[model samples]
Target: MTTASEPRTSTGVPLPPAATDQPPAPPGPAAPPQGPPAGTAAGTAPGTAPLRALLGYARPHRAVLLGTLLVVLVASASGLVQPLVAQHVLATLGSGGSVVGPIVLLGVLVVLGAGLTGLQSWWQQRTSERVVRQVRRDLVFRLIRLRVPELDSRPPGDLIARVTSDSTLLQSAATEGLVLVANGALSVVGAVVLMGVVNLELLAVTLGVMVVVGVVIMLVLPRIREAVARGQQSVGAVGAALDRTLGAARTVKANGAELRETGTAGDAIESSYQAGLLAARYVAMVKILSGVSIQAAFLSVLGVGGALVASGHLTAPALIAFLLYVFYLASPIGSLIAGAGMLQQGLGAVGRIEQVKQMAVEEDVDDASPVAVRTHSTAPAVEFDDVQFSYAGRAQALRGVTYTVGGGTQTALVGLSGAGKTTMFALLQRFYEPTAGQIRIGGVDIATLPRSEVRRRIAYVEQESPVMAGTIEDNLRYSSIGATDEDIAEALRVTRLDALIERLPDGLRTQVGTRGVQLSGGERQRLAIARALLRKPEVLLLDEATAQLDARNEQALRDAVDQAGRRCTVILIAHRLSTVTAADQIVVLEHGRVRALGTHQELVDNDELYRELAASQMLVGEDGDPVEDLAPVS
Candidate 1:
């Protein structure tokens, strides 16, 4: 429910042009807050505990990860010995002794290291895939179970981006990203220790250069994380733009708004690109610094070691091994830099994924906790005890609305659009809770019962009559999956859809196009009614069920409702006053308040609002006859 004063968009006779044929433009979807996006429910801000959450995703795969890391460790250790072995070969040559033993050992180390590295690569990737799969599955499960209000508050496209794009980021960041950082640190430490053993003066020169460069790079990495977060949000906005436009594709086309929508989506795309460039700028700087750090250290070591060897403090072979170690240090520095960047990006992704995880989801209520709902059939007389409700950030939709609907009777709610008509049904279904007041069903307060339990006893068909993408049988069986074929036929008969189904070549198996675009407006309305009837609910609430039907089908539907009313509570909302004249009770609402309550004739005689509505439809006039004998207009 949007606003009490806003009328529903209606399709009727063309209005007299206000200077031209153009009609006043309808409103658009309300924009959600841009900060952190509206999709995330209440939780800690984006930066909190992202690293811990990333570690948690890989915790279950630690054993496999440990095994893979051991293989890489062996490979790295063998590579570390290559330079030392070369020094031995050089010494043996200088002594004029056999070098066969040293040469064979070097060849063996090379083969072993290569083999282990290959095996580790494959094993680590397999584990990474498993981690990604679990994260995606968990996200999907939690997203589907989120409470109604959370879903109502967010854009679906943005939420979907978390499951898809964010999880993909986690794929490497949680697994290989950690491996890179750990292995790089170990390799760097090993190379530094050997460099110290070979020559302390050279090691001092290398350490000084490394420490300064490391500090500079650390400061810039966090900026990458911030840029990535902004980029993810822009991408989500792009998705939202496309989703909004595609949902109303026909409306956009009818208004010739292709260019306008194209610009909207293009703008979002441009924002994403700009954000990507910022992150890229930071990332490129880190890579350049990593390379520069190694080159600077090598130059200092070369200059220092040359003087040491010339002064007879360092041997020629030792200087060569020390130089080899400095060059070997390059690989570890590069990996360390890459790993840190990946971790920062992963943390950014985790921020989005964690927001999804924190969003509140509906929990199943215990059937026998503090209150027990009766399983046996009872007249579910609905009573609204001064019900007052309001949407978030909006004025009251229903204000102190109170009424009692007798069980097993036909009651109609008559009001102009947004007079709290649809809101009444939403409250009954527990889609949104009432702000103040109580709703009782069968002398028991409904709030004490579980939402699923409350909904099980009632069925509702909305005015638009939305349809799903599937065959007729699939949609009919959506609410009651266990319903039998015979039950479906009976429901179709009641809503006067049996004949239409029979006319189709596929009968019950006929495919309904997306949102049931394959069916006419009247046919879709009837199909929704049929689907609701199959539930055999204790209470049936229809919102303009007959609005799209022809005279004959509308009368047939009313007859079916009249029959069902004898066995169950039937309440309906109707803008056309003629259809509700035969109702056992009529509640007239105006501006979120009940204006009058009585039989249709009584209201016509006494209530000005009800009388005006009736007169507008020509249902009653100065000397108009009673409405019961007249056929209802669809």
Candidate 2:
């Protein structure tokens, strides 16, 4: 058992202390507690670091982004011309001249501006989608390659939310944020210059008022970033809660915990609601500030410019044009404020994405790497030499376990629960390395080979017989991609699954419900075995494959195992002594140590623990008489 103080794997499984020769553990998922609260200042929180990283995602599509920006600039410039055209008409009327020329020009400018705005929007949206696709692709690539330990420590729903909801926020930030900042700045500067041309005194008044209000708005802008960051965190929490309940839907239903699960989900939803309210409060404040500043600038420009016009220092047409510019300031100022908010939210999301990217990933090997071939003529197919392993400060799970299974022979591992039968297979599969020991396959140390190469040479059927949600053929061919129809049919026949397949309405194409709910426990076990057989691996590891089977199926599976044993090395774990009675050898384990190694009869006669276990299942009587009714204790 693992101790409380022990370090755990990413999946919460306790790990043994690292050997001196072993590398350090990989970095785990970023903790949620490190995120900023709703009231924290955005400048001092996530800051520009995340924004810079987000820009890297847009680098490859810079040409499209630049084109989009050019369109936005053209649209803004066209809009600026409208105000000038209007001024020309007003001046022409004041001078008692024809207004037809100015009116026609104004109409042309409006049409051109509207068309450019539509084009800009389409291009921006397309670019945003491309950025989103790239971000999600990188996230998924990192997720699949992340070390197993790191994967164990994180919630699946939270990761999914990062890819879906968080990436969407980045979409808006990447395109809209860039365009707003660029176009809004240009519009503001152009408006100021036009106002100065009308009257410098009025221009000064407008700038003075705007400067004061802009500072106040800038101070409040950071608060929106903090609120949005917290809101996104709450959204991730909601996703995690939903995943927890839905993933185990049957368990919740079976236990009549509907109300309890609903309550759990409700709490998460409430948190998200509260966070959203906080974000909205900040956003509303930003809008109010922007509106107030624009109104103040308009009043200032009108009062100052009217006085200049009365003094004969400014013309009526010029005053009217200056007022128009004051009104036009609203568009760009509003865009600037909104863009800042979007960028802040994007920064928050990028922070989370960056955290995932920083996680340590396992080494990826080439899929075309050569598979290990069995070449040894006299060496044992599998050998464990003084293997020792512990689960993070706990007693050893496997202690000095030394054993060998000859090539092309069957070996039975007979042990009680927690006696390290499964751990042995884990070691062989290289899921966890022994603290001190050597494991070999075909006389070659497995540690010297790539993980993929080792796994390619062996096929494992777990005790639970897990199946994916797909057709019968999908699950069967999952391991062996190149398996032909004839090979699959032969495997089914060998595992006695031909009858089950024939009964199905669609035969090999029949869909298996989630977790193989459509199949019986016995049928699922046989299917798992058949799937392994189809791989044609050099070594086959079966972890209690017949544990769920009926007597007839168990006998048929045993015959199938016997047939497989003739072609490849077979290692099996069985609790029932009768199952291993005719095995080539039986290795009895107790408390992480090998207690005896001999034939079934030899163990029954020499090992007390074996006899007691055999008696409990009625495989043998206390008086040393064999039970007559038990058919291999199936």
Clashing pairs in model 2, backbone N/Cα/C closer than 3 A = 10-149, 10-152, 10-153, 11-152, 11-153, 15-392, 16-392
349 Cα displacement, candidate 2 (Å): 2.1
Reference-based lDDT, residue 61, model 1 = 94
TM for candidate 1 is 0.90
- Cα lDDT tens digits for candidate 1, 337-409: 8888888888887887877766656565322422222353754788999988766545677789999999888
Cα lDDT of model 2 by residue, 1-634, tens digit: 3323222333233443243112223222222322233223223344666767767877888898888888888877877777777888988888899999889888888898899889988988888998999999989888776654455445667778778888998888877887787778888998888778777888899999999888988888777666666777767776766777776778779999889877766776677688778778888888998899889988887787788889899888888887888888899888888888887777767777776665546454435633334444432489999988775546678889999998888899987777888888877877666778789998888878777878878889888899889998999988877788999999999888898789888999998898898888888888899989887778889988889987778888999889888878999988876777888888888888999998877877888988888888788887556878765454
Whole-model alpha-carbon lDDT for candidate 1: 0.79
lDDT for each candidate structure = 0.79, 0.77
- Any runs in candidate 2 off by more than 4 Å, and if so which? 1-45, 365-380, 386-401, 433-436, 585-596, 605-612, 621-634
In terms of lDDT, the poorest run of 10 residues in model 2 is: 20-29
